[model samples]
Target: MGNLKLFIGVLVAIFIIIFLLLIFLVYKNSNMKKNISFLYTKNIELFKANNELTKDKADLNRQLNGNDDVFSELRLALELDSVVNSLNESGDGRKIGMDKKLEGKFVKSIPNGVPLNFKGITDNYGIRIHPISKVEKFHQGIDLRASVGTPLYATANGVVEYSGMTSSGYGYLVIISHNFGFETRYAHMQNKQVVRAGEFIKKGDLIGYSGNTGYSTGPHLHYEVRFLSRTLDPINFMKFNNIFYDERKVPWQALVKAIDDF
Candidate 1:
């Protein structure tokens, strides 16, 4: 009887040890699975954050490109303005100081568009012998000679200030104030039609016809560009992308296409 009791006690002890070992293995496996799950969740969050960062980088690049394009256009406009201003004042021996106050204001006002309808240049801006007076004088504008009835158009959007003859050598002058310190004048017109003072004129809108007037010796149009009362050369302004004559319209498109291709 004593031996059987001892054997039964040993058997009970072995079974308890086995059961405890099984329970420990089960707990360890469950803990390992929980750790793996946490690692997977962490990895997923990191991936999502990385994707968002990539998208933000792309968007920032696009904005930077857009800003660059705007800056390029602004720089071109400023350069053209400076060249025209210098040419108009050249040979006069009078140095006109840079108009800092008018720079920002004028640049914001002139919109991009073609200014005139006639092609070819008869005269450039500088000191030249006056065709009519035969005296050395400063030419403040450029001459565009066309047919007597060729339509003269506004270069930019503005309100007309004067549309009549002036003794200052402008036969039939049309002055348009574009505000922001920029104004334009069309002189030596054969006739004035479809425009008047205080009338709102857009770029390419007909203001008059080109002709010999205002001390001109031949059939030509005198076009003057001004900024803050200072006369600027019309030639430099004509080099801008917005300025064009009838034949120049197609050439402008071709130039733009070439630039795009490049």
Candidate 2:
């Protein structure tokens, strides 16, 4: 009877040990499940944030490509003396009033180079706030930052249409008339311009020097390019081959034909 009691006690102890081991395994499994759930939730949140960043990047790129004028600041005036109404009441676009003699002289009279050696660009072409007026307006040209007396060059082979002081805010300016209805203007120039009105000039010819003249906060060259009196971004002409002429409503085909025929 004593031996039977000892066996029964040993069996009870074994059962108790098994029960405690099972409880420990169950508790460990519950903690592991909680950890896995937390990791999964954190991963989902990170994925959502990454997606939002990608979308923002795409939107910013679209804005840059679609509207270059969206970032324009500081106004530059367009006051060319010879500019006529490019578009008539009928909206007939791009009337090329080329001087036959001038066209014959220069077949390559297209503005395709930087007007001067500029350190950098302070303002780009488009709508922007006028520094003096503090009001929004259309800026017709780009402002190239350069020190006073920096030598300016003719961007194309053309005849000087105007070269003198102007009360219209571009203190001393020079406008060159080229073939294919294209024209280039250099503004805020020093009082002494080497070229005069009706003088023939070739591409890269020294025209004048930059200055702090007329509506300017500092010494800079305000450069402009136009086709039939319509303002075009000077940047496009600077990289002449890369100009998106179609989007800017210029007659690329006519220009090509004129050049070819000439």
Which lDDT value does model 1 have at 76?
Answer: 49
Residue 234 CA error for candidate 1 (Å)?
A: 1.4
**lDDT tens digits, residue span 1-262, model 2:** 9999999999999999999999999999999899999999999999999999999888777665544343211010011101122222234654445433333333357787788889999989999999888999999999999999999988888999999999999989999999778888899999996999999998888999999888898999999999899998888778654353323456444454556457
Clashing pairs in 1: none
lDDT, residue 210, candidate 1: 83
RMSD of each: 20.3, 12.5
Prediction 2 TM-score vs. true = 0.59
Candidate 1, residues 73-134: lDDT per residue as tens digits?
Answer: 44544454453234334366654444333333333345333355667788888899888788
Per-model TM-score on C-alpha atoms:
0.51, 0.59
Global fold similarity of model 1 (TM-score): 0.51
Tell me the whole-model lDDT of each prediction, alpha carbons only.
0.70, 0.77
